[model samples]
Target: MLEVRDLVVNYGEAAALRGVDMTVRSGETVSLIGANGAGKSTLVKALMGMQPVTSGSVLLDGEDISRRQASDRPKLGMAIVPEGRRLFKDMSVKDNLRLGLHDAAARRRGADGLDLAYDLFPILRKRSRQLCGTMSGGEQQMVALGRALVSRPRLLILDEPSLGLAPIVVAQVFEVIEAVVAQDVTVLLAEQNMHRALSLSDRGYVLADGSVVLEGTGTELLQSDRVRTAYLGES
Candidate 1:
């Protein structure tokens, strides 16, 4: 559903991404694994049109969207649960989720999509009237995920969904993601937790210094000697 080829991004003289190539087919989950500063976020921003691409193409469903505006992507059936779960602190939970329906189709889905969100995370329905900032980290993450899903996106991109949560909560978040995958939403996950990322993904790519260093099926990567040494901390 999504393809990025020879993608490069530069900050003045420094290149944040160089010749990165990856693909997420329809009805599949793909993971991008890398250490901090490996250009995962850069790639995400570029794909979403938040960052300008110095070169290369971002194709969605076979059309080039590289030059499209950031605000235009959501209308084209793309949504993101960004790193850090950026949310409105003072907004009620329902109000926060309602922001996802910016496009006409999403707005048309309306309360039906809201129901889907609540079904995905029942806690969100209970907290509908509560302020978002006062919620726990796990709760906030749930809100972020719900916000993305309520948009009825065809391609869902998640950045660091496991960051700064207890192990149990992280597991719960992964479970929710798996549930989403069961519904056949194409997913592109950028995560630092190599084990969890690869485990949930059908295929995975490793990025280093802004380039794709390796690519394989999740199980293949998990058992790779190079991956075991570099990312898995094993010899």
Candidate 2:
């Protein structure tokens, strides 16, 4: 459903991503796993059109969208739960989620979209009117996930969804992700939690220093000596 070819991105003279390539097939979950500075976020930003691609092509269903504006991405069946759960802290949960409907088609189904989000995380329904900043970290993360899911995107990108939550909360989040996968939404997960991410993904990519170092099925990656040593800390 999504393809990235020879992608490159730079900040001034420093290259943040260099000649990277990736693909996400429709109706499957794919993981991009790496360390803190391994350019995972850079790749996410590049895919979402948030960071300028120095040179590369981003294709969605064979259409080149590399130069498309970020504002237009949501309309192109793309949505992201960005790293850090970037939310409108001062806004009500419902209002914050409303921001995800950036196009007329999504807005037309806004009511149904919201219903689905609330159904996925029932706590959100009870806290719909609460200010996002007053919510706990786990609750706030729920809002972030809801905001993205409310758009009913075909391709969902989750960047560091487990960053600051407690272990139990992280498990809940991944359970929700599992449910999402069951719904046939293609997912591209950029996470540092290697085990959880790879375990849930159908395919996985290991990024290091702005390039893909390993690509394989999820179980294959989890059993790899290199992945165990580098990310899983099994060595």
Candidate 3:
């Protein structure tokens, strides 16, 4: 559903992504696993049109959207739960979810989007009017996911969804992700936590020094000596 070709992104003279290439097939979850500075976020940002790509193309369903505005991408069926769960703390949970419907196509989905989000995370429906800032980390993450899902996006991009949660909370979040993938939404997950990311994905890519160093099926990478040594901390 998404294809990134010879993607290059830079901040001044510092390269954030150096000729990275990757693809996410429709109805499949693909993972990009790497260390803190390995350019995973850069790739996500570029694909979302939030970051300027120096030279490359971001194609969604075979059309080049590299030059499109960030706001435009969501309308084209892309939604992201950004790395930090950048929620509107002062707003109510339902309000945050409402913001996701800014796109015309998403707006057309109307109440169905809200129903889908609340269905995916029932806690969101229970706390519809609650302030986001007062929620727990896991609950806040649910709100973040709810916000994105309310857009009725075909492609869901989650950036480090497990970043600051407890082990139990992380497990809960992964369970929700599993449920989401089961709904037939294509997903591109960028995460530092190799095991969980690969475990949930169909295929995985290892990014290093601003480029893809390895690519394979999830189980293949899980059993790889290089992936184990580098990301999984195994022998």
Candidate 4:
């Protein structure tokens, strides 16, 4: 469903990605795992068009989207749940979710998508009229996930989903992810928790310094010596 080939991104003279290549097949969950400064985020942002790619290509459903603006990408069925669960602090939970739907009727009435969000996370329905900022970290993350879901994306890209959350909350988030995958949404996951990421993914890619160093089925990669040493710190 998504493919990035030899993508390179530079900040002035400093290079972030040198030649990253990865692909996510339809109806599959793929994880990208790497340490800090490995250019995982850079590769994702390049695909999202938040950061420009100096060279190479990004393909969505077999079409080149390398130069497309971030705003334009969403309407084409690509959505991202960024590392930080960014939310409008003062907005009501329902209103925050309403911002995600692009349909004029749904965005105007907010009834259709709001119901869907409520179904995904019943907590959001209960907190519909409450300020988003006052919610707990887990609640906020739920809201972020709901917002992305309401848009009905074909390719869902998640970055560092477990960051700054308790283990229980992180597990809950992963559960929600499995639910999303069950609905046939393709996932591209970048996560620091190598174990969790690899466990959930159908396939895995190891990123090092902005390039893909290894790729294999999740179980295969998990048992590999290189993955153990580089990411899992296991013997």
lDDT tens digits, residue span 101-214, model 3? 986788885558899889888889999999999998888988888888887888999999999888998988888888888888899999988999999889999999999999
For all candidates in order, the CA lDDT equals 0.91, 0.91, 0.91, 0.85
- Please give, for residues 145-212, the per-residue lDDT of candidate 2 as tens digits: 88988978989999999988899989877887887788888999999999999999999999999989
Please identify model 1 stretches exceeding 4 Å from their true place. Answer: 109-111
Name the runs in model 3 displaced over 4 angstroms. Answer: none
TM-score for predicted model 4 compared with the true structure? 0.93
Q: What is the lDDT of residue 139 in candidate 1?
A: 84
Better of 3 and 4 by lDDT: 3
Runs of candidate 4 exceeding 4 Å displacement = 102-111
TM-score of 1: 0.96
In candidate 2, position 173 carries an lDDT of 79
TM-score of each: 0.96, 0.96, 0.97, 0.93
**Model 1, span 10-51: residue lDDT tens:** 999999999989999988899999898999999999999999
Local error of candidate 1 at 175, Å? Answer: 2.2
Per-residue error (Å), model 4, residue 185? 1.0
lDDT of 4 by residue, 100-161 (tens): 88655335433465677788789889899999999987788888888887877778899898
Model 1 CA lDDT for position 89: 83
